[model samples]
Target chain A: MTATDTAARMLDRGVTPERYARGWHCAGLADAFRDGKPHAIETFGAKLVVFQAANGEFGVLDGYCRHMGGDLTQGEVKGDELACPFHDWRWGTDGRCKQIPYARRVPLRARTQRYETVVRNGQLLFWHDPEGSPADHDLLPPELPGVGTDEYTEWFWETVPIKGSHCRELIDNVVDMAHFYYVHFAFPTSFRNVFEGTRATQFMESKGRPDKAADAGGYGDADMVLTSEATYYGPAYMINWLEVDYKGFVTEVVLINCHLPTGPDSFTLQYGITVKKPEGLDDKTAQYIAKKYAEMFGTGFLQDVHIWQNKAPVQNPLLCEEDGPVYQLRRWYEQFYVDVADIAPDMVARFEFEVDTTKANEFWHEEVAENLRRRDAASEADAPLEGAGH
Target chain B: MASFVPTSEETLADQRLYTAGWLTSVSCQDCLAVVGVQKNSAHHTSIQWSAEALAACPEMGRRPRELHAGCPRLQASIEQAVRAGQVPIGAGDGF
Candidate 1:
């Protein structure tokens, strides 16, 4: 190919840089920032400071002090304000200078940018708008079920910093049904996608491969079925309500998967899981089970990470019939990257797609059976020879 | 059969039954308690035991309900049944 042709091809396949999505992105677990200490978060090409007041209120402000560009996170928290490490200038949660220990008077214009933040389901989420628009608290995600109740275990959180891939790659999984089998060892029986204004949902019912299911402890029953209804509130936060039905009993699990763009091509993906205490189980056993489930679920996300780390961004993907609505999902996701006034009507229009899993199920069933047969044969081959030691 | 009735939409009656619908009951060699058993694959095994079966197994009867794992005698009996073609692997049609 000519140099011009090769350059054009690269451009066609490469993901172009775009502005960060405007929505509430989770910074981390709420408890991580409630120790009366300020934590620094790097995202959107800027640094932010997250701190909690003595009266149990959370605050997020620009990391640098407006007075002398001092790192506030490296400073101390004095009462309800964060003090700068350089000159000990105390700034309130509202980003206004409260006291300057060395100055006679605080300047009227001595202030920094403060972000709107909320704690939902044990997650700390801060609003991010590219155009500097104020956040609407009414648009926040609803409270997750069984979050603070005694019936559910505490949230188990995990974060993976992924590099060299746009956050869109993760969003594409909302419509990609075929990856469940190949990547996650799940045989999806039914799958559906719904996209509306600022929200996209994926409803899936699946059966795990016997070998993979065995690793999930009590969920190893032959008749176990997994159902998940995962919905993205806006661009970054997704809440998945999962149910694992094991013939005689059922387990309810909630998974929160959220991300924030650290750069134009890199993002930090985080996921937390909480499991309802099974009936007749001790609290210790329930906690153990929840931890195991979190590890298993984390493995599934890492599988996606492996593929994303090695693959190139595809602008025009060659998709088949059962690929779900990738184009429609991208259209819906585009609304967040652009200014509110420039958003197209189609970006917020409702679109629904239901994938027919009959063909995929047929193929997956055979593949799973073949895999099981191979495993059994290999086990027999590896078995000790009869009377070998004798 | 279990007398517990599922109340919520999350619980399905069909999913309560064993995937291997044709498997016969296998009696524990030590406890002599019969229970329905099915082996879907090398890794998945489902056992349906009743109150009477639980009471009959001395090992299970001595332990608390929460501490009860699978009875070793019953597992051995099921493994023998699989080897004898009495409980076939991958015989169910359910996913």
Candidate 2:
């Protein structure tokens, strides 16, 4: 297409609004907030304070106090309330003013915006709705299958602040079947997408390329087959059940990829991983595997970050058959952007798209062979002269 | 598997309103079992198979579930169907 045609197409697609999606956004690891101290968070273009009560209940409220606008997160946690540092005014988890140190009675209307909080899969998530609607608990991400059990290690969480991109860029990866080969270095054998209601799922079975994997920190071997079923519970949270089988040494990993918008053009991306402990393995070894797997996963995400940092937002993407259902996935994602009344039937309607990977597999196999040939040639050139070294 | 069954224009128009608008039913040339197929591009073909179709497939029935990536016979049939314009590719063409 001509530049003018491209510009016109982009104009027709329009710009993504500077708005945070309405759903449960993760704050951080739940363990970080259970220290009986209020933790300050910046998200959704607003400040929030996450605190835990003595009884282990978590509370999320506006970071500023009602009276004099004091930063509540800097204050101390007293029982089930968070005491404002500026005036020592104690506020209950319900957002009601409980006590004023010098006043005879606290004002009945003295309250701040309290967010609905849910702790699932060991992450603290707060509900956000631009329309101020109450959270539907049913819409929250379900509990991970192997988490919190003896079979899995504790969650290893990492948060990175992504700049110059909207969070939707990350969400678009759900339907991008081709990205696995080009971006993540996996040759997808079969790829499918299912979008229904508030959930969008991607099912993929892929074989790893050794050359590409080595460049991305040697995470995968050529013989490995990675099968993953990843689902987005809402706009931000995605739970991926990934199984990597390398010559029968199988590892099942639960990867949580979630993010919260910090600004119109930026977001804080957070991902947590928990590896299932193999039978007869020691706890120390299991813990080590979990940490290494998390780092390897982090490296994979960094690759995407590099692209998102420089890429422009494309609303009407020119897609191929192997591209999966990008438009359909975006339509499903629009449900979170609109009010309940404005949501279209197609947005929630069930749509399934599966890419026949027969051709892709053949093409990727050839590519991998070509890549390996180049790598071997380079390695041979770089090798020290065998007799000269002796 | 290389032979394509010519579909009428009326049937192609009717396919646009199917639940999966981009997909059209193509029968396996060997087994004669129908499976929904869509070729989004030259390199991408999507096939949706029903249980009855899978059961009727001579090749798929012999293979274990885990080993079944796709039936080669059906894949060849789908490719031929796409080449003959029996399957629609590109956005909004079928829908």
Candidate 3:
């Protein structure tokens, strides 16, 4: 076979760079970064080495060094530069050859590709675009109650590595509403979906009982109706606001689901959850509730993971009357994988759908206001007698 | 005693001299982090430096990481050394 044809066959073996969307992909949680240490992670069909300089500058460089193709992960971090183990060639955070221990002259072309990085909500994200263009839109981390404040417990994170499926396959599961009744064993009473260009929102009410729900934090150990409002920033990140109602009482929990594609056929599913703490609750109690809620969500999400691992890629499937907007969702997802020129006008038009999540917004906004009020009150209490002291 | 000229002394005092001290790696006294530098490329063997890696530097907690990376003090030293034609340019095993 010709060399060009062979390269084409190789691209088809797994997801090539062209299939990668222009968006921010999760690098890892903020706590994972250590100063003066290099972290090597595989994502977007490349091996990336991330490191924090002695000055606290974060840099993402191509894992291989320019000289002798040395593996940078084995290299030592020197100040803000990474020193390659093979030759002690020091690379600056900008991927430029800052120093060569044995050579006085540095090559002009001695540099590697550096990915753009941004830290948000305690998570590090790197922008990936096939064409090397800057990110067009900003992906904001959802504003949830207790985030960055003591009023809410910190997010308890759980990671599960999946094989034999692409990240898009996992994203597709979000819009597959029918799976709740069959796979998760929850009966959905109503479902609403909204798709506007890059973002999609799904609001659903499911009738189910928590296997072992906590009594504190307004949660109960009884049968409850679960209402969920999920907002997708893109195909990679989602913020799901879940409200568990036990008769008159309701507790809100926000689940931030971020999927990082490790390879063409593999990805890591990171699930982080934070629960709104009840007033007058101790730190220990709040932390316990957060952990329990995280585990509960982990248990439920794994059901979908089990099915996803075994299922093959279905390009086209016979649609039933009851199946939720799977085809329309697929049309929206096409823009991520394929170029704009390849997509039809009719498919592009399907991206304009809307769902009302007014109640969910009210619930979150109220919690934020309460947290701010409590913070203000605490600050006032700490203030000394300003007029008398002067 | 008199200031010796380059033709008589063989090494200029103003030039960066690569001394034996350049081989020794120095770290921040506070954070105990190693400072990055070229050991043998210049006339002066050893140089003193400081850096902060983040906004809240775990070591000093005073400067932003970005400011530390692009510190004018370090840049000014390099620029002065280069303009004076004192920094070595020929191929040699870098220190």
Q: Report the number of the highest-lDDT candidate.
A: 2
Task: Write down the worst ten-residue block by lDDT for model 2 chain A.
Answer: A381-390
Q: Which stretches of model 1 miss by more than 4 angstroms? A: A1-11, A211-223, A382-390, B1-95
Tell me how many residue pairs clash in candidate 3. Answer: 17
Clashing pairs in 1: none
DockQ, all candidates in order: 0.01, 0.08, 0.01
Question: What interface-residue Cα RMSD does candidate 3 give after superposition?
Answer: 34.2
lDDT string, candidate 3, A157-246, tens digits: 887888888776777766665566456545555566655455666777766413223211122133557888887776687888888765
In order, what are the TM-scores of chain A for the candidates? 0.91, 0.93, 0.78
Q: Each model's RMSD to truth, in Å? A: 17.9, 9.0, 27.3
How many angstroms is residue A12 displaced in model 2 relative to the true structure, after the best TM-score fit?
6.6
Predicted complex 1: CAPRI docking category: incorrect
- Candidate 3 docking class: incorrect
Model 1, A1-390: lDDT tens per residue? 333322442223433445788899999899999899999988887889999977777889999988879999999999988999999999887778999988899999987898888898888898988788888787698897678689899999998999988899999999888988777767788887766568888988987656545443322323657889998999999999899775646889998889988887789999998999998999998888788778777888988999999997765454444566665677678788878988866566544455778777888788777966887788976543221110
Candidate number of the best TM-score: 2
lDDT of each: 0.75, 0.77, 0.59
- What is the Å distance of residue A33 in model 3 from its true position? 0.8
Higher-scoring candidate on DockQ, 2 or 3: 2
Residue A8 in model 1: lDDT: 40
